[model samples]
Target: MTTALLAIDVGGSTSRATLVDHAGNCLGQGRNRGGNPGSNPPDLANAAIVAAVEAAIADAALPGLTIELALLAMAGPKFKAVQDQLETALKALGLTGPVVFTGDLQAMVASVTAATNGYCIVCGTGAGAVRLRDNELDAVIDAAGWLLGDAGSGYWLGHQAARAVTADLEGRGEKTALTSAILGDMGIELNDDRLPDGRPVPYRHFVDTIYAMRPIELARFAPMVIANRTDPVAARLLAQAEDYLVQDFSMVFDRELAGPVVLGGGIVAHLSGLQSRISEIMRGAGQVPDIRLVQDGSVGAVVLALRSAKVTVDEAMVQSVITSIAAHGLRARA
Candidate 1:
């Protein structure tokens, strides 16, 4: 019977599971909601992880195969606390071998390069930077949380967008296109009531709507902010985001590290404008950055899983896994 490897990437926004064999063939993949224990309730995160793993097992349809090992690359700081629960759930699903958990940053860096020393920058619902020495995390910056740091993150952008609109509505800030755009996006209309400042606004409606949601949910406006970059307010927000992200990368950057600098997560990977700006900044600093993008941590999990099994994973093996994942339609956001 062919042995299988289970690899999972759990993030602040989504969780993914991929089942692959030693030959680098992706047998099946599954996805579920965010499963970050630090950012989400432990029960909810555990549930999401189990759901994704179960779905992947179901998708494989090869019940006879034994899962030899499982590796989960997890976002958030508190995943270790739930490791026992996760292992129990995986065993119930037929994971036969030992389970390993590691920081998501390792997977992010491994997804793009096998080199031992490198830098990683993640910008999704949150933002952070890390330096990897010998394939282990050596330094970190930001990644605090929506309420704390996470500067240049998706939540940060959305929060800035909301603040800009609120300021404009109250007549305390410069007027910009974000006011109408945000209101329309939220399906909020201008109310007849005027604020004490005499500006016609939907203060009550907007405030009530925003207050009703968890602060992290503000990340929903990130894409809108990115989309409305033509607006002066949005443009300024993006500029600030870019600056913050660049700052994160710079803080952990080592001029002597010879390995590639890997960037993951939705914001930095998908936003060409931000990517270009960051590249420009790095170049201006007289550093020739070997930047690479891994859309999510899934591929990195696969690489780590293979390595853990003593499989000699070269670039050829990694590329084969990448191709198989794409063929199986498991590539997350490409």
Candidate 2:
């Protein structure tokens, strides 16, 4: 009997779905824009998720095939709500199977660490860390939200950059290339008309401008802070972000868990310097955590789905699936 699995990873800005076989071999995948329910209205976010999953199944040419299992890794505390909506939606779409809901960090751990006893730290559009002990969720230091937290995340870096630019424009901070770069990117002239009182505008306006841009494009600016890390202002911001991540992970380490720390998400995949800095800080706290990056959570999602179906995932099988995934990329449908 041929068995298929559907795996979904829902994040703050987008949702992804993958179709895989019992042996961890990927068959198809799809993605769509959708923020976390904590950040967006539930109805709107759930609609986007349903669309993404349908598109993936259609792209896979697997219509009418019975899925053996379905796994979801959703962001935010409202995971159960999202899971319920997804299960009902999938059933309406004719997918009958065993469904499991969990945090996005958990899926990253399963994908990268390959052990139930490990941790996964995700720093992408937002930042958060989670640890597992004996295959159970043991601890977490959530980013909360961009307004209150998300330190060490792309949004946090971009937000800081915007603040710096505004400060320099207002003559409150030293001028840096970031000021010119940001204004140029936004196509906003710092003329008198644009600045009514001939004074620099509020920092929130600039932050809004950054947010208005596409996520990937906006996230690209995060590395600029790292690139200019030597500058006191930039260094201060980066250090603070790194510190938050260290604290988040340290809280879990304090519990005395025996597991390596696995890192995931867009920011972590792109920011080696930041990860190294956080690792150093963790060491100073008397915790030596082994860290590695999981470039794509879908890889782990497939593994999870397969395991749920009582399928074995050996290295050879994992490598075969990974090689296929690499060729197609997580965003590409198999």
Candidate 3:
């Protein structure tokens, strides 16, 4: 008969759902593959979301408990469509309550610093930063799609590596270990004008290739672009990425609010050095701000839901939530 709140974080590559009581103790949790309704086809994305939520509810084994509220954090630009799809999925699950749907960035911002007033820089499959001041969204920058933007993201990094290899082969750029590494990893010959057998290499192929490699492997090639930051041939590519983020934070400061900057997303979490470099560069421009990284955004979503619902966030409550989430054993399972 315990009423529980559900928090869901849907990223570009995966989704997670956690159930917690009024005390912030997580009761059960579930996870599945990515379900970005804005990016994926409507029907397919909705099905995936429903499946993940149902699996989590079942995993919790709280058969008869009623869900009091469901807070969803989903990635993508189309918030209304995502909300409608989520509501339909919830109805299909035979459970309903006060469901709140918001951007994945919002949950991410709340997660890192646990602050209602701050900014969040998310670098994952894509890259972007958002700021909230006094609980109101203030600024957002560089959230453009893969083709035009998303600097410092896995997709961007991988795409750049591939381009560099091609440039070197064409005698347009300096040779680097990334050329051979990319070829060996993808099992493709570097000299081939097109992908093996005259077919173009799929863009996603490069994305997966870079993501599948170890973090050290990717970082090895990422810094090469830093040296070329000013050359039109390479100058603005990497440095501009960092600059874009710095600009995003500057916008927040221009608003004259006192808040730290929270950095989240897989890319930022794994590449602390890159984030530090970006921060250092930003410091030289004046208005040096605090930066914190959030590895797991779901934890923040849970915290936000608890706070918004008027629940106290004490150290003991935080520990209880961690224990409950760990007891479910789903973090690694996903």
State which candidate has the highest TM-score.
1
Candidate 2 weakest ten by summed lDDT: 191-200
Per-model root-mean-square deviation over C-alphas? 3.0, 3.8, 5.9
- Evaluate all candidate structures by whole-model CA lDDT and list the values in order: 0.82, 0.71, 0.64
Native-referenced Cα lDDT, model 3: 0.64
Q: After superposition, which runs of candidate 3 have C-alpha atoms over 4 Å from their true positions?
A: 79-82, 169-174, 189-240, 270-289, 307-334
**Candidate 2, 1-334: lDDT as tens digits:** 3447888877767888887776666677778876367655678778877777887777678546667777877766565676687678888866677688767887787776567677777887778888788778888887666656677888788777877887787778887777766676676665433355565554446656766764434555676776676777777777777677767876666435556678887767655465676567557667675777787777777776777777776656656666766775644623
Enumerate residue pairs that collide in model 2. none
lDDT of 3 by residue, 1-334 (tens): 5577888887656778877888777777777766665445556666677777787777767767777778777755655775676786686665457677676777776665545677777776667778787766777777664555666765566567667766665556766666556566567554444555554353335545656754323433444443333435344455455565556555554434556677877656545245676566456656475776776788767876787678867546655665666665754476
Ten-residue region with minimum lDDT total, candidate 3? 214-223
lDDT winner: 1
Candidate 1 — which residues are off by over 4 angstroms?
79-81, 194-201, 269-287, 330-334
> Against the true structure, what is each candidate's TM-score?
0.89, 0.82, 0.74
Q: Cα lDDT for residue 101, model 3? A: 69
A best-first ranking of the candidates according to their TM-score comes to 1, 2, 3
